[model samples]
Target: MIEIQGNIKTVGLTCGYRNMPIVSDLDIVLPHGKVSCILGKSGCGKSTLLRTLLLLERPLAGDIRFGNLSLNKLTAEQLKQLRRQTGVLFQGSALFNSMTLLENAAFPLIERAGLPRGLASELALLKLDVVGLSRYAHYLPSAVSGGMRKRCGIARALALDPPYLFLDEPSAGLDPLTSAEIDDLVLEICDALATTVVVVTHELRSIERIADHLVMLADGGVAAAGPPDQVRRSDIPAVNAFFSPQSNAAPLIDPHHGLASLLLDEE
Candidate 1:
């Protein structure tokens, strides 16, 4: 198993597209060997922050440091070395349609780790099993359901056994049962592999199921950061509204019934 010993610290971090920052002066520390979920309402820069941590985008300012290595200071070769120790599961799953599940999962090991095809295949199969998709190893992406494709994507991410894993909205577009299954899979992976996982999600159910540490963002800042239980009781307007949205909800209406009918009923 890989040994991930230190926290990922972002000091005064600002992220956005081009010059106009969406989130600014953010200071958050992702604890070591834990599942840290970045939570917020939609379009609040959670995904953007994840991208910055993955070095897919440059930070407008500040530094992203993992243990002793500063991301901003790394040379191209150094950055590549750093990235090999990290894994990312994109929102779309991003599986190649041309390849079988096993082949797609093994591609990372073969390309990045320089493992022989046989060994890579073995490792990939093991990861597939971890995500409960080993039975469908030879199936094409098009043949699988969305959840199965997500499992395959996760298997590929784990192919190289990276200690640090980042998953962007893994539960999005999935049914509640399938989404819960994915949540359980993440917890299982973290326990079995001692992996440090950072999940960017707005799903309350997911955060409740898997998050050990929580960071809720609003107005380009950390509105609340703490354990799940504490964040639930947070008094901050943005944080509170996010967690207990139904508290101030409007009267229920049947969308299938026309709005005019609802108004007539009210009248």
Candidate 2:
């Protein structure tokens, strides 16, 4: 079993921009080797929370830790090292228009890791193959469908073999079938590689298929945080509404099992 300290966690965290808080007093735990998704409507701070964890968005208060490395307390060198262990796929897939899929995937190995070009290309092809993009390795991002581009972005993110991967809106512009494919790939990555993944999205179908744990945000804080079933059963109207958008019914809340305690009292 994974130890509590080995998981990525937040302590009384407050995330925001320009001093305006988006989410406050958060104590979230991303269980080691699991897929934990952040779910909410637009402006609910799902992406802000993720970016805070990545240190791209500065936290207004509180602390974040990945294993024993405290985000707020790290030395510059340590922080840099920590960043290397993380990979990210931005909302738009962020691929360079000029680079072929293979070249884009290999860019990190050649530049960030300083690997030789030939070896990097060989390893990149393997990553592309993982995403079923071997046939499109030579295609530019503009030449492929949005789903394919997203897949390539995912491949590039995996090139560094980071233990943690953060994906933002991975199914944003895709059809239902393509969204399902992305969900399948996420599950495959988590199960086969044992990579801890944090996805920020409101795609219900994708979330249902891939999320092992859920953190639902609303009213500038966590509405519910727990296993998918438990969160789905939350009495919080927004949380229930998300899981059952077609109706106005909401499940009963177990006051004995408040969400804050899930992290506050973790062993």
Candidate 3:
């Protein structure tokens, strides 16, 4: 299990080549074995926070630690080992276009684990089966639907069997039905593998479905952090506004009841 404590302790966290500070003085602890969602509007440092945690970007000030290992204390070799314990599913289904689904999934195993091609392919097939994409083994990214491509990305992320999974905007761009399906898949995978998942997304529907814990980001910091119900009841205006359905927001559909309601109405 991953335990983060004593706050993120960031006096200044920046982004980009100019080193512009998007989020500053940020402090939070992401508990282990929980499905935590980082909610924020676009350009509100959500991605920056994720990158900071992964050590992809060096902070201008402060520090990050996981369990007992502080990011500052780890050498290059140690940092690589630490990263191996985490799996990241990037936004836009960032699968390589040239590689088949099987090869895409196997890449991590080969590169990180240094496994032979035969063994890596065997492991990749197992992960593909877990993601319900076994039939798409030979298919390239272009051949599959968007949802399938997302699943393929997930399979590739899981290739190393990381204990923690980070999903960046998992529900972005997908239709509501497909998004809900992805949520269900995330829940299923978490339960089966006992993985801790940290999802960064703005979709309220996705939050309602998959968030075991919630952290709302606004004004360059966390607005609230707790269970979903507790977050809904928060007195903070920012929290309420963040979760409130916007005028153009997609209608909240109960995944289990939607089909039934439609079928019964048609009767």
Candidate 4:
């Protein structure tokens, strides 16, 4: 893993796409070598905030600082150089369907780091082992299950041994067991690589299992920020609603209730 250390700090951040704002006047700190989860309801700008932080999308206002560099002040070449310290796993895994898992994982090292193909493959294989996908290195993404594909995405993200990692909805489409496995893999990555990991997700279970720090957003601003347990216990209505656990109650209506009536709700 790359030897990296730095906290990500935002000052008066306002983020959005085009000219429209999604989140405004936000400030948060992501500690070094920790797993921070960005949590929120749908349409609450969690992903927007992350994209702005990753320098993928420019913020509408405010400044983002990583280590000593101001993201908004960097030149194109400088930004590219700074980006080498980071890796991203997109929501869909985003692997090339035609590339073998090994090739996919090794692409970053070859393209970004200018390593030889053979050496890149060697490094990629080690990353694959880290994510428990070493045996599937030769397979195409299409040939792997969704869970395996996500693991391969993780392997590729670590191929360059980045000190900072960003994952968007890492467990989005998996079953409960598979999602839990992915959560475990995420924890393992943070521990083994000592990477500063930022995960954008709404999966409550995953948050409870893996997050070391939490930033919860409501309507694009911070509703709460703290450790997972503290955020869960917050009296803030939005926080309470989001962290509330599922109940084990059966339906109150008769099993034979008509679909239309159920949909309309009885007066």
Candidate 5:
């Protein structure tokens, strides 16, 4: 990995699109070399907060600090440089349909790192192997299952060996087993690479399985922030309502993707 160290700190952060705020006055610490999950109900601004942190969307208010650099203080060149140091796996997996998995995974290495195509491909293969997609390196994204495509997205994200990784809804649509496999890949990435990973997701099981630290948002601010088990045990009514359901019997569909199946699945 890129050997980045230090917590990503947000001071008085208020972010939303089109000037209206969704996450207001939020102060949270994303620790170095840990997997932090951002969880909340639909429209609660989990993704908005992440986008602002990634500098993909400008925050309406607040300051973000990574190491010694402040987001608002960075020049255009510094902004570009900061972006190149981080990796993002967008909700869609954001792959090129026309490229082979190898080519897709190697793209950032070639484009961002200025590596030769052959060398990029070689390094990309290693990343694919890390996500258990080495055998499918030659397959087109269209030819693989949705789960494989997500893993390929992960491979692509790590192509540049970035220290900070952001994933938006990493396991949004898939069977339970597939989602769990993706969760395994996430754990492996954090443990093996020691990358600071931030995920925006609603999957309770995935959170229980992978989250080293957790931040739960409600009412445009932090309802809870800490370790997963501790956060789940919180007495906040919204938090109780959110996690209390996990103890109940899971429905016919996997409880994780039950927005269409039932309640507490929204977001």
Candidate 6:
């Protein structure tokens, strides 16, 4: 239900602590209720784009709007309100080792939603159930496997029931099967909650499985964008190279063993 009209225009968006420009002239429309994957090679400004969109990094010269509200025009309080409507999952599952799974999941609800501790705990358990991690509620983050930790992170992200969900490299450290599971969970979340999802990823298998739309970033701009099928069919060299199998040079690994191997396995 979020209609992003005109364009999410960025004339000269930049990043880094010194405010240097990592990318520029980035224009994109994230369309409502769709899962958009921002794809790019390493250090091609994909993460910079996501950070700018999330307002974690400032844009050098650009205007961002969500619905009718101009992001730049919003006051600090208003910006906080806007952020409540969105949830973000960082690259590494970013859970606190000191907290149990339930406490980690409930943190946002208690802090942002201002719910009572009892209520927050109840809601967190429910979200954990949704992510199929209810049994791990009492376990510390350090006690779980990598995949479980990611799922815990997902549960925490969903705790607030935000309309927009942003995930950075959801499958970065996992095996193929685990990655596919995360993709399926994302798809299910979108289907069940009708949440608009923006994911930053370099994995083609993930893009093929979960992308409702694709945005390819290169040379400080969007090289191409559309539905996955349309993007694959694009004549643009950058777009074609991105989707082309020949461009994938990463070592194949067994999903179970998490070890590099010579076998070419399909998820």
Residue runs of model 4 more than 4 Å from their true location after superposition: 1-4, 245-267
Task: List the candidates' TM-scores in order.
Answer: 0.90, 0.89, 0.85, 0.88, 0.88, 0.86
Tens-place lDDT per residue, model 4, 204-249, is 8899899999999986799999888888888887887777635432
Off by over 4 Å in 5: 1-4, 246-267
Per TM-score, the best of the predicted structures is 1
User: What shift in Å separates residue 66 of candidate 6 from its native position after superposition?
Assistant: 1.4
What is the lDDT of every predicted structure here?
0.89, 0.88, 0.80, 0.87, 0.87, 0.83
lDDT of 2: 0.88
Of the two candidates 2 and 6, the one with more favorable lDDT, higher being better, is: 2
Candidate 1 lDDT score relative to the true structure: 0.89
- By TM-score, how accurate is candidate 1? 0.90
Worst 10 residues of 2 by lDDT: 248-257
Model 3: per-residue Cα lDDT over 1-267, one tens digit each: 343222223333443324577777666666666788988878788998888877888876677666667776877776777678788888888899999999999999999989999999999999999888999899999999988899889999888877778899988999999899889988987788777788999998999899998888877777788788998998787776676746344334654574655565443
Give candidate 3's error at residue 182 in angstroms.
1.5
Comparing 1 with 5 on TM-score, the higher-scoring candidate is: 1
Q: After superposition, how far is residue 42 of candidate 4 from its true place, in Å?
A: 1.1
Per-residue lDDT of candidate 6, residues 1-267 (tens digit) = 333323233434454345677777666777666789999888888888888888987787777766667877878777877688788888888898899999999999999989999999999999999888999899999999888998899999998877788899999989999899999999999888888888999999999999999889877778888898888888887777767758743434444564545447865
